[model samples]
Structures are given as C-alpha cells and as structure tokens.
Target: MPILDPLSFECVSHSDEQTQRLGARFAQAIPPVCVVALQGDLGAGKTHFARGIGMGWGAAQELRSPTFTMLQEHHREPDAGARLYHVDLYRAERAEDVASTGLLELLEDNDGVIVIEWPERAWDQLPPEALRVRFAVTAPSKRNLTFSTQSASAWQTLLKFRKLAFGV
Candidate 1:
C-alpha cells in the first residue's frame, strides 16, 4: 500500500431520504471508475445510500442489498454497457473470501462504478484509492455520515459533492 494524504468531511442526515439524496449528489460527482467502501452497522442506511447512487448513475434497476448473493450488477440506461456493481462483504469471514468474489477484477474495471457495503470484512483487499464512507445512527431517523478518501481525485470528487449538496 502507498502512503496517502487523507481527506475527509462529515454530514448529518435527519432522515433516510436525506441520506439517499446526499448519496445521489455524491454519485453525480464521482468518477466512473471509482470504488466506494461503505462502513456501518446494520440499519445504518448503507443500502439506501447505494440505491441513491444507482438512481443518480442512471441504473435501469433499483440497487438492493446483496448480502446473500454478495454481488449485484445493475446496467445503466443509454449506455447499456455501463454498469454499477453493488457488493456486500458482511458474510465474508476472511480476505480470501472477498477475493473469491472477483472484486479484484472489478477494481481494475474502468468502465463502471463499484459500491461496497461492510468493507471492513476485506479492508486489506481494497485499493488505496477507494473512497470510504462511515455511517452512524444518531437517532431513530437520523444518521451521521463521514466520507473519507486517500486518493486525490476522489478527494476532489468529494469536495465537489459537498459543494453541490451543502453549498459550502
């Protein structure tokens, strides 16, 4: 792994809708070949956020949790060849378990975006450029989301997303 200049920002969502909207804004700013690592406990809105990413990315189908299946691929409209890969590593017990899911190949795929939930299951397998989002449930309907990244390009994308979503 390479040393990186980490950058991060935080935002609070008062509701699930707000979290999804924030995710949509981020989706608009993220690069096509990006990798996103989502970290949070169950009911932290990770799947909701990923659904918004799929919406913003023009996916033909809704993004859903792939906990059992482990991976779900959604094709984008207009660009039928473009895809959004949603990965859930919650069930994985080892880094090798994640490796067997073909995540390594997806990381090298430049024509699509990848969003991973429960990335802590395979942190060592993740690329250094991955943008990470940590979620915390603050209330029955509230959530705190922290976005961080070591990659400069992903940092720029997060800045753009923040400006667009928060006007700051």
Candidate 2:
C-alpha cells in the first residue's frame, strides 16, 4: 500500500446518523481480526461510528467508548464468536503504559475485531496493516472522514467498502 494520502478515500457525513450510516456498511463488510485505528478529537463521533460498526458486526449490545474503563466488548450482533473490541487510550499517559496493556497479545488473530480510539496515543502499538480512520468535525452536525490502509488487503477492502457505502 502507498503511504496513505488523505485523498485515497473520502466520506462526508452531516450528522451522527450519517456517520453511523457509513459505518454500518463498513461493519457489515469487515472481516475478522481487523485492527482499526480511529483518530479524532474530543466528541469526534468515534463512539457513534463504532456503534454503527457494532450493529453491523452483529453486536447484540450497545457500544460505548470504554474511555475510562479502557476496554469494552460488544457481543456480535445476532451471533457469537464474531465480535468487536472497543478500546480507548485517552487516559493512558505514556507509550509504555499502552505497551504494558499487551498490545502484541491482542493482535494474535483472535476471532473478534479490535477498534482503538485515541490512536495517536498508541501509535507504536498498532498493527502495521491496520485501517486508519481519521474523523474531523467540521460543525455541530458535519464531519469529514478519511480512510487509509497500510497493507494491500486493507486498501482493497477499503476501496470496495467505500463503494458499497456510497452505493456507486
């Protein structure tokens, strides 16, 4: 994959629902063991977007940021085995702290998926082939999302997934 330019993928949503709408498609299309790094500021709608993914991932429960708790697992919607890991590194003060969380252990091809919020805080812990989703809040109800992939398979999936999300 190329060094992920901002233009490689684009998604603009005017509301949380719109963001989630796009996220729903991604969730449905996603394969297992995906490491997703969600980058954004406070109230950037990362949680809402992940909720959409949880719903599409067949999660049976609600999806929250797990910011304070560090990690939360949402049962796959309407199923089991297939799952989602919602992680927040907002409170982690150091890279070592993030490392001590056993990031390598988490990347071991588990049956579920991993979603990381505040990814900038855990840069070195992320997988090399992870999908990068950067969300920018333009207004109270507007957002711009940029997607990039670090591996060929992830890039291809992102392309196909973007087309499906746009229905074009």
Candidate 3:
C-alpha cells in the first residue's frame, strides 16, 4: 500500500558527524522489525549514516562497513535488547548472490535492525515495508539525505522520524 500521507523530508550534512546525527535520529524514530534500504553512490555517506544508526540504537561496539567482508554484526547493550546487522551488497551484482549472502534469511528473522548499502541490487528480495533512504553527494564534504516509505506502516514510522529529525 502507498503511504496515505506521502511525506518527504530533507537534511543537509556538511560532515560525517552531522550525517551520523541525522541517522541517529532515524534509528530512534524507526520501529522494530523494520528494514532500512539505502541507495547512494560512493562517498555518499551511507556508511557514516549507518554508524550513527548503531550508536543511536545503543550498540555496544564500533560500527564498521562490511564492504569487503559483506556483513558485520553489532550487538546492543543488554538494556537495549537489540542488534544491528550491517550489510553491503556492492559486490553482489545478482539477486542470487544477494540470496547467497543470506540477506533474505536475515530479513525473515527480523530480530533487529538491518542497514543495507547498495540495496538496489536486491530490490526484488526486499520487503515492501522497507524505509527507503536516498543519499546524494552535493559537495566535497556535504550530502543530501532523503527518507521515504512505501507501506502505510513504514510511512507511520517515517513520520515519527520526521517529527524527531525536523520537528514537523
């Protein structure tokens, strides 16, 4: 289902820290059993944003991109009772490759946050309720981040983030 109240919000970040701050807001605003689909080119600050998500979500360790290893798992503190699975599909050219990486299984488990970079590679396999976030490099050290959701439930969660991130 489409978002009954289709919403759009934009944030500009001049540094990695600012980008992460926006992501932290997103992490806190989004609900559980949610998928975050990140679409962006290289140097678009996707990883930085994911790092912020880990922090905002109360991860107990440093967050890192799984570009070469393809997957990284971060456990939240006991009080948080959550986890973050960071996945990079930059090398997964085929949907089959994405499947081989056990991403579909991870989504099916739905026990924690899953932040996917280069999500377009597994578009067909992703959930319809995913929060689609797009990133654009506007300058050498600047980025434009946009968040959108397709399903009604996802839209509701996006609205929460909107209020927290933009006070609107």
Candidate 4:
C-alpha cells in the first residue's frame, strides 16, 4: 500500500451522540493492532468517543473509563482472540510509569487495538505509526476533532473512516 500524505482532517461534533457515531465509524474502519493517541482536555469527550469505538469493535462488556483501574480490556470473543485496550495515562506522571503498566508488552503481542488518553505524557514510548487525534471544546455543545497519521496503514484507515463517517 502507498503511504498517504500526513494531512489532518477536522470534524465538528455538535453532541455526544455525534461524537460517538463518528468514533464508531472510525473504529469500524481502522485496522487491528492500531494505536490511537487521543489528546484533549477534560470533558473533551475522549471517553465518549472511546465508548463508540468499543461498541463498533464489538466489545461484549460495558465500556467505561479506566480512570481508577488505569487499563480496561474489551473483548467480544476471547476465542477469536481480538482485544481492545483502553488505557488512561492521566494519572501517570512519567514514561516509566506508563511503561510499567505493561503497555509495551501488549503492543508487542499485537492482540488488538489500543486507544490511549493523555498519550502526550508518554510520547516517546508510543509507536511512530500511531494515529494522533486532537479534540478541542469549541463550544458547550460542540467539539472539534482532528485526525492525522503518517503510517501507510494508519493513513488508509483514516481515509476509510472519513469515507464511512461522511460518505465522502
């Protein structure tokens, strides 16, 4: 596959439902073993977006923030072996702390998709191919999302997501 230009695409979500719909389409189109680095402030809708991802990815359990537990694994079929790792690093202050959470081991195992919040805290540890998404609160009911990636597969996934999300 040919690598695409690392151009960013932006979308404005007017409600949590819209954000969830967008995220669902995004997860449905993305490849497995992908890493999505989410950057945004509190109440920026990252968790809501992640819930959509889990739902679209066929997660069997209820999707919730792993704020207290730090990591939550979502799997629809254990026998099928595909998993989704939802990691929150907001409480982790150092890269070592993030590393100690066994994220690297999971990445190496290539068992599923990884969606991380507060990824900037461990920027150095993330794979270079990771897709970067930024969410900004533009209004009380509106959030702006931008997606960018350099990896060929990640870029292709973004294109598919865009097409699916927008029918473009």
lDDT of 2 by residue, 23-72 (tens): 78888667777888889998888888888888777778878778778877
Q: Which stretches of candidate 1 lie over 4 Å from their true place?
A: 1-6
Best by lDDT: 1
lDDT of each: 0.85, 0.78, 0.84, 0.83
- TM per candidate comes to 0.92, 0.89, 0.91, 0.91
Give Cα distance to truth, residue 110, candidate 3, Å.
1.6
Residue 38 in candidate 3, Cα distance off native in Å: 1.1
State residue 98's C-alpha deviation in candidate 1, in Å: 0.9
Please give, for residues 1-168, the per-residue lDDT of candidate 1 as tens digits: 112235888888888888888888888988888889999999999998998899888899989899989999889878998878999988888877888777777876645798999998877767778889989998999888888887777788888887888887
**Model 4 lDDT tens row, 58-168:** 888867889877789888765468889999988888777788777778777767899998888877778878888889999998998988876776777788888888876
Least well predicted 10-residue stretch by lDDT in candidate 1: 1-10
* Residues 1-168, model 3: lDDT tens digits: 123246655677889899899889889997766789989999899989998988898889868889887888788778566668899999998777798777999988888888999999988878988998889998999887788776877888888987888787
Please list the residue runs of candidate 3 whose C-alpha ends up more than 4 Å from where it truly belongs after superposition.
1-5, 79-81
Alpha-carbon shift of residue 133 in model 1 (angstroms): 0.8
Scored by Cα lDDT, where does model 2 land? 0.78
Q: Candidate 4 — which residues are off by over 4 angstroms?
A: 1-6, 78-80
RMSD after CA superposition, every candidate? 3.8, 2.9, 3.1, 3.3
